[model samples]
Target chain A: MIPNLIFILVFLFASVLFYFKVRTIAHDINLGKPVEIRDNRLMRWMHMLKVAIGQSKMISRPVAATMHIFVYVGFIIVNIEMLEILVDGVSGSHRFFSFLGGLYPVLISAFEVFGIAVVTGCIIFLSRRNIIRLKRFWSSEMTLWPRSDANIILITEILLMSAILTMNATDGILQARSNQHYPVVGSFLLSGFLQPLFSGLPDSTLIFIERFCWWFHITGVLAFLNYIPYSKHFHVFLSFPNVYYSKLEPQGKIAHMPSITKEIKVMLSGNIDYNAEGSAGEIGQFGSKDCRDFTWKVLMDSYTCTECGRCTSSCPANITGKKLSPRKVVMDMRDRLEYLGRNIRKHGKEFKDDKSLLDLVTSEELWACTTCNACAIECPVNIDPVAMIIEMRRYLVMEKAAAPAELNAIFSNIENNGAPWQFSNEDRLLWADNLEIKTN
Target chain B: MDRKKIEIPVMADLFARGKKPEFLFWVGCAGAFDDRYKKVVKAFTKILVHLDVSFAVLGKEESCTGDPARRAGNEMLYQMQALRNIEIFNAYEVKKIITICPHCYNIFRNEYPDLGGKYEVVSYVQLLNAKLEEGKLKLSSELFSGISVTYHDPCYLGRANNIFDEPRLILNSLTGNFVEMRRNRRFALCCGAGGAQMFKEAEKGDKEVFIERTEDALRTGAKIIATACPFCMTMLTDGIKYKNREEEIKNWDIAELIAQSLDL
Candidate 1:
């Protein structure tokens, strides 16, 4: 009973700490962005409801959806099992779930059915991932933890659930031998098969084994709770904010370019003080080389990505033989930011000037983007890769002047001639001259 | 021969009557410059005149609206052009305007508002349909016999401004055999003319977007491919030639059909 109380206190304390740690990380990443409250209140609410509660966006692919649904439902239904574990720890009794006469049986049966559902779902999921080898389900950035952790968690859950069923059956048999009324016939039937092995065992041995299984289940759940913030399983909490704070603007509106003309004027006038705030360093308008250049919202978007390849599949530029995959762009940026953040956290002042990590992204990949919003539109998590691309382009154009030659020519043509075409305005009226029409 | 004198005469006539029209008919760069569209513009003008709706033209003073400049990413030139047009309109006290070209209509109605310019803008088809509904203009049925036509919804008019039904209404009133392309209205494909692609050569793709759209119109099996935008008409006409299907398919602006149906 004392151990059970300690377990409850430890679990509650760990969960609260993990929640705050994730919240702080999310908050720090999203600090500078303008708050994007969508204009349509009802539409926002509906989208939130569909994405957060329904898991509608994550279920886009069949195999991944099935696997995720099992894990998700297992996490939910297993809470009742968690209560049983806690109660067992408190009372030192294996029949903790059987407290309320008929109610206990009903609850046990419900959990048993859900456990079977979860096991079958996870089995299908594992087979699909390992055997079928679906390319879309594979993430280049999948960490070691979730990959192995998921398998371990699933196996442990199944074993724990099976052990609970076995314990109940064994208890039913013991109860029947002692002449106590057992509620479930299936429990008695299950116990009948195990009665021969248990007949020779002492009562104290059964009690010790039941207590061992209860402790194992309780510890497994507590460990999972502590591990949530440190792992990719953090997406469970992050998905809600990711869906709610989606970009409200039309996809076509690219990130606003900084007014370089005003800055250039001030710089040339030798009044560096006046233009100090807006002046670019010697690198010029090149492109985003590091995480600091990314908008705060983009950094948030990076962490929120489920590594779903829906963005990659729908991207027009990627389909058209371009090196630009919007999914890779976000993932690569996230990788670079994480790498840089790790270095900054560890080495601090010593690695302040270390530009080697900035080479994580290439200039070609940055320039190849068409700024099409297909990635943003198809992204179930509302990750705006287009916004990130535009920010990178802004840096390339303003800081480095390193944009493609074709784009420069286009700008020049618009500058010198009134139109993109060099055609003489004298001949503009030629198409209208011979028509049999009255002038306005 | 006096260009300025020629421009202000229509405005002078409006001033002489001590009354200003609701809109000045801004016959845009395409309407004033494209030969095929000029006839359509003239037909629209005739309809307005017959309906006794007062309007004036800017004549030679009206240049390009800089939609071509803006779409090509030269915001400076676009701003200059837009500012110049706004000044001229403000000077004339033109509170409302109508344009025949959807590109011009979109620039004037939608884009110009962003540059501190605002005016009630209408497409000619909208004005024409309203006039028709008011019974101010009448049409003869001789233009309709054996004329199987289909309306190609220009992307700017349909998708950009949501002006789908006005053109369809005019076509329906003019001819009974107006078929629709498989992708019509909002889903209408671009004729590869928008975003300044009309002035420049098309980018190399697996298939020409213009040709693809033209073939869609051709597949409708209509003799006449009717459109409301001058750019669509020109591109679709060129697309027909490129596909070697010009003999099988012909392009006509909606106003031209309406003009042909007019008793005059």
Candidate 2:
């Protein structure tokens, strides 16, 4: 009864903490401009299934995809065992699902098999991060915290699987000794290997070890759940909705800003009074200046980014050693959103900070992007870093009037002469002039 | 070279004569201004005149599609240009447009519809491939018999719109010597000419993007680098010149290659 009470208290505390943190994240994302997804609903759902559930995009890199599949599938399937663990903890029982006769052992044996796969995958992943040191994992933006964050998640997964396997191991030994609590169930494939280690121990010690593992496993699962809001590991859940809400238009298409559209329409309709100061108070907000300026989908994208660096690796500018790293751009968005989100919570939504997302993702990094869509296409989670960069550029050019001098010339040339160069529109058919040479 | 006269129809002139062409030839800004890309426009027009595909150029009335303006974060200018172009297309009652440049094709096909300009926009490669498959166009293999050819997929054409197979199929039909660069199709590297990069110097980097892509084409040992977009054509042409491989490597647009193969 005491153990069950302790379990309830721990579970409730974790749930409450997770709920509050997740609410903050949701609140922060909601602060962004609400985007209207006017795409086909079926297509969106299909893409979500293919990208998030199927993980279809990860298949490009065979080795990493293969290991990732083992880890992803194994972790997901083993979490089913979490259901049984929850039941056992609440009732202060051991293997409560064992009443299913032979089926319980089959179910547990399957989970144990997957648990082994999870452990193996995690070890290989750890080696890839630490020993082999894949270049993507060690890019300039992948600071100490991010590297350690990845390691912590992998180690935690391995440790959690260990606890489950160890718990089953001790439970099997107790069942073998015909203990009152642990009913006689057939051995699991994974945990059965370790039964002999504890077989020599006394029943009292075996019970203690089994209970300790059960307590530790439940507590660790709760801790991991709460850690997700602070970690990149939250992608496991956010990826689904992020993929669903991602744009359906051609990758090259940049979404038009309706606010700008309205203003332009008034000017085009000759509604602008040139003499009047041009909406001076509203001049500050044009493109994305900070976290709040990003659309809801972009904010969600920041949260969903796993920071795997596939986008950066495939980026042309990044490949040529340019300042732009798409992964870093997305990471900065999340960091700024978190910083701003915290401030908003403490000082209300209207709190204005002098620091913008551009301060972190410099205009230099944003300008280096070619708007090629390579980064967007390469993102495994369907995050469009290009969209964020373009939004920031819009802020720089439209609101700040701070485009590069060359581009400013290009803009005026296009505006004045109907092309990006100094040539007149009358010179458009000069190519036809050469064809006329045949007549002479 | 054509000493023979071929009449290039203008939309204003054709419509003035009460004759509507089947397709509007969108002579993009690069197709008009760049000296090298101007040849692409002429070659493509030659093919259209040869095959007797009814197409008309907008001539002086044509304007920029604002692709560069939008990409450079000048949406106000982009919208202004887009609105002007859309009005001209509407005035001509244009039903279909054949774009020589992928950037023009991309803007016309994808972005223009949002600004109330919708037409059956087709890239030259797509149009050429369609003609080839329909048995309307034939290539004499003797023209490119000894020359090994490789294709550089333009970012606008390949990754943005998935117009990969059409260019490849056209090249394959023309010559068995056709080869692929290391990063072809979706994995294609940019030619350092996108997003207003052509108008400005690239940010500090170890190697130029065009140089990197040029190495990919050079590594293939293919003599002729076939391109579809004018921006890509200019970038690769400069890349070849920079490496002093211009004599060995000829950067020709696919339209130019097709025109040559047809002996037009």
Candidate 3:
């Protein structure tokens, strides 16, 4: 009864916490532009299934891929044990696993071995993250909390599984001594090792230890669920929608530049009078300087990043000694949005200062990008960093009139001569005239 | 200036009169303007005529497709120029527009749609391949006597439009000995001429991207460097000159090869 009550209280508390965190993230993402769908419904579903469930993104990296597969499989299979614990705690009878017949014990044993393998695999990943520090893993922008939280969660999981083994061993010993011929005594392989410690303990003492472990396991699961929405673990939920809604157009296609004349006409002629109301200037030009400048889809992308470092690792700019890391750009945008949300909540509609977020990303980092889609192609979460970079460049070029001198000269030449070359337009047909081919 | 000029027959009313020509040859800006490219364009036209494909030229009515302007962020000018070209195309009722230049092909096929223009666009290699398959074009026994060649995949044709096979197929069918550059197909390196860089000087970097790409082509140790795009041909030719490798390595458009190989 006590164990059941503890499990219910912890589950309810965690559920409430998760609800609020998810709400805040959803609200902020909807504050930007709406997502445009280009792919057919069937194609979108196939992509989602392949990328989200198949772990296509994670498997791109071989070593990490293998480790993740084991952990994912173990977590899914072990969920049945969680249900059993919940039921047994309420009824005071651990019959769930036993009801499956002769094969149930074998299945449990197989899962037990796989759980140990998952624990081992996780340990390897933790060591790699801290010691080997692979370039992709090192540059990941995962929140500081999630990294340490993962380690704690793994250790606690190992402990809970160990406790389960110990309780089973104790029960086997007690039953053997009481002449209760149990069919599963042969399956409890750890009984001989645990006999020295719990052979003299009373059956009641053994039962108390089992109940205590059951409560710890349930509480740990609840805590993880509650913390998921607030941590980098939020990617688990966001990754699906992010991949499904990913841009289907060719990577080189730039966003359609909005008509400048139409916007100006609307501002001047509309009854609402945006210019008169002081919301816009005489020559209206829309550009994003911070997180809010991005569309809602871009904002969602920022939060959906798993910080897997696939993007940064594949980035030519980063590989060639440039300061721009596409992953960092997305993370920085997310951080700024969160910061601005806090300010808006406190100051309401009058809040204005975004100088800090603007300062976070430099023009050098922005210009260093070659607009290559390598980062986007490599990202497991389908975050289009190239689009974000180009969007920022558009703002820099069109609104601020700030760009590299050479690029500026090129644009000027194109505007004047209809070519990037400085030569006279009269010489344009010189190549044709020199050819042996007859003119029309 | 005493070179034998190849005559390109003019037929502005061919499409309007419902005459089904073998091919509608598109003479791009480079083909019409660049000195070296003009010879190659003439050669390409002669080869198509030899293949018995009745072709027509746009003559003085042809204008810039505005690809350079669009790529350089001058969208307004691109729209203006594109609209003008669309009017010409519509007037001629051009159905299948074929060009030796990958840039012109890309603009006509991809960018023209955004400006409300539509036409069936094909590259020179694609048209030539069809002729070869139909046995209209045949390879000569004289194989240039052991001259090795390597094909450079232009960004527009290879990456932008996923056209890597047709050029290679034509080259392989023409010459038994053909090698590939290290970076080919989708992973091919840019010739630094893309995104309107051909019209402007390259920005300061450790090395010129075009030169680097040309070096990759030269590293294959082939006697000749072949390309389908006029921009790439011009850029690679200049790169060879810059490296003082003009004496060692030569550049040729695919059309020039077909023209030279023809029994005519």
- Write one digit per residue (lDDT tens) for candidate 2, span A1-440: 98888888999999999999999999989989877886799999999899888988898888888889989999899988888888978987777888898998899999999989989989999999999999999999999999999999999999999998998999888887889888898878779999878888999999888888877888998999999899999998899999999988888778876666666766777777544555333444878988888899999999998889999998889999988999999999999999988998999978987888888998789889988788888788899998898898888999899999999999999989999999999888888974732321
Q: Between candidates 2 and 3, which one is better according to TM-score?
A: 2
Model 1 lDDT at residue A55: 76
What are the lDDT figures for the candidates, one per model?
A: 0.63, 0.88, 0.69
Which order, best to worst by lDDT? 2, 3, 1
In model 2, how large is the Cα lDDT of residue A153? 96
Which candidate do you rate higher for DockQ, 1 or 2? Answer: 2
- Per-residue CA lDDT of candidate 3, range A1-440, in tens? 87567666666677788888788888778767665776587887788888776888676578888887777677778667777776766665654567777776676666676666677777887777777766666553545654675566556556656666665666567657663423343355433466678777776776676556556667767777776655556687898898888766555555554453334335456754555633334434445677777788898898897666777776545654456788888878887877777677678845778374448777676666644455775677788886777667656666677766776775665456544544445554454343442223
After superposing candidate 2 on the true structure, give the runs of residues whose Cα lies further than 4 Å from its correct spot: A273-284, A434-440, B1-3
Residue pairs clashing in model 3 are A32-A296, A33-A295, A33-A296, A431-B33, A431-B34, A432-B32, A432-B33
Candidate 2: clashing residue pairs, number: 0
Prediction 1 global C-alpha lDDT: 0.63
DockQ, cand. 3 = 0.21
Q: What's the C-alpha lDDT at position B193 in model 2?
A: 89
Model 1 residue B207 distance off true place after TM-score fit, in angstroms? 10
**Residue B150 of model 1: what lDDT?**
89
For the record, the alpha-carbon RMSD of candidate 2 to the native fold, in angstroms, is 2.5
Candidate 2 colliding pairs: none
